[model samples]
Target: MNGTEYRDHRLFKGTVTERGIIDYILSLDESLRLNYNAYQTIVFTVTHRKPNLFRSFIHEKQRGLSAKMDQALKTFRQSEIAIVNALSYDYSNGLVEGINNKIKIIKRTAHGYRNFSNFRNRIFIEYKLLETKTAA
Candidate 1:
């Protein structure tokens, strides 16, 4: 595993391969290449958690870009504060989100149980928090 491998994974290598494909496609059109490069800069800034760099790059480099990129930048600007907070802090809601996703999957698979107790029991069973009560 090489080229920015993490935990023995070659994710960035895959990214590089995909980027080459995109670059080739984008190079077919000058406008598309420009747009792709601009978008890549934004992605790099965000990935590195550089809000200040993002602000500067958006202000300086994003002028006269495509309408779609403008809309995306507008959305990012609107959520700038939240984005900055996310980049600045190490807090995560991943555990809670994972549990919520599991519950949703369970609900979908069950197809609407009529009894709430049974639903709760299913959750407890999934989490291994309850044992089956067998009759002798």
Candidate 2:
């Protein structure tokens, strides 16, 4: 899959959970070592904006501040490296954000979904449909 597609997948999300997203990201290239902290800062900022999700994932299992900090530090080190290499490239995190907004718009437009499966299908279908149109 393309970068955008790769970023949007639940498998990638799971990787973020399992291996830590920053580790996976840094593994993509060794040149990414310089700006790792910057990338982590952005990620931490975004996570703060979604406190519920953050709390649910990291803190729910009684994992305290120390564990969280260690994880964040490990992820940040690699992320800083990745961001350094990414500096020269004019990549927009906007695409992923835009896709998220589009998904919200879809849910709102359709008055929300009844179940997770349907929600997943709807999003997958919507993405595929948009991809087809763009390809054409």
Candidate 3:
């Protein structure tokens, strides 16, 4: 009924397949259809936890998702194992990196440290290593 309402509909806003248009449009040729399907499959495989299937999805059926898509596929092919690990694993080093950055900032703020002992004590207090000292 309204602009936003119309845009929210699957036909107007969702993927071509979800709109029921890409099904017929992309199905015109075997190669073209395969390319389209492979692209969609890869997109889903990367975002979802399907490491087992990602290898086949990328290397097996990915023929050509148009000219532009071929380059992207090539990149994925080169890092196939990494891509699979990313999709399948639930771990990330982001937290460790963030903590490292915080430590760097604290060290930078304390300008003149002459010895390792002073630096070590400062780091311990910064991280609240001694509960008694921190409580006071």
Using lDDT as the measure, which candidate wins?
A: 1
Per-model C-alpha lDDT, please?
0.78, 0.56, 0.70
Q: 1 or 2: which has the higher TM-score? A: 1
For model 1, how does the per-residue alpha-carbon lDDT over 65-128 read when each residue is reduced to its tens digit? 7899888888888888888788778888999999999999999999998999999999999999
Q: How far out, in Å, is residue 80 in model 3?
A: 1.8
TM of each candidate vs. truth:
0.69, 0.30, 0.53
Expressed as tens digits, the lDDT of each residue in 1-136 for candidate 3 is 1222223344455533343555556667877887777777777777777887877766764444676677777888899888878887889899999879877886799786889777777777767884434454
lDDT of 2 by residue, 69-122 (tens): 557645645565454435434566899998999899888888978898778778
What local lDDT does model 1 show for residue 12?
A: 37
Please give the distance, in angstroms, between residue 103's alpha carbon in candidate 1 and its true position after superposition. Answer: 1.1
Candidate of highest TM-score: 1
Backbone steric clashes in candidate 3, count? 0
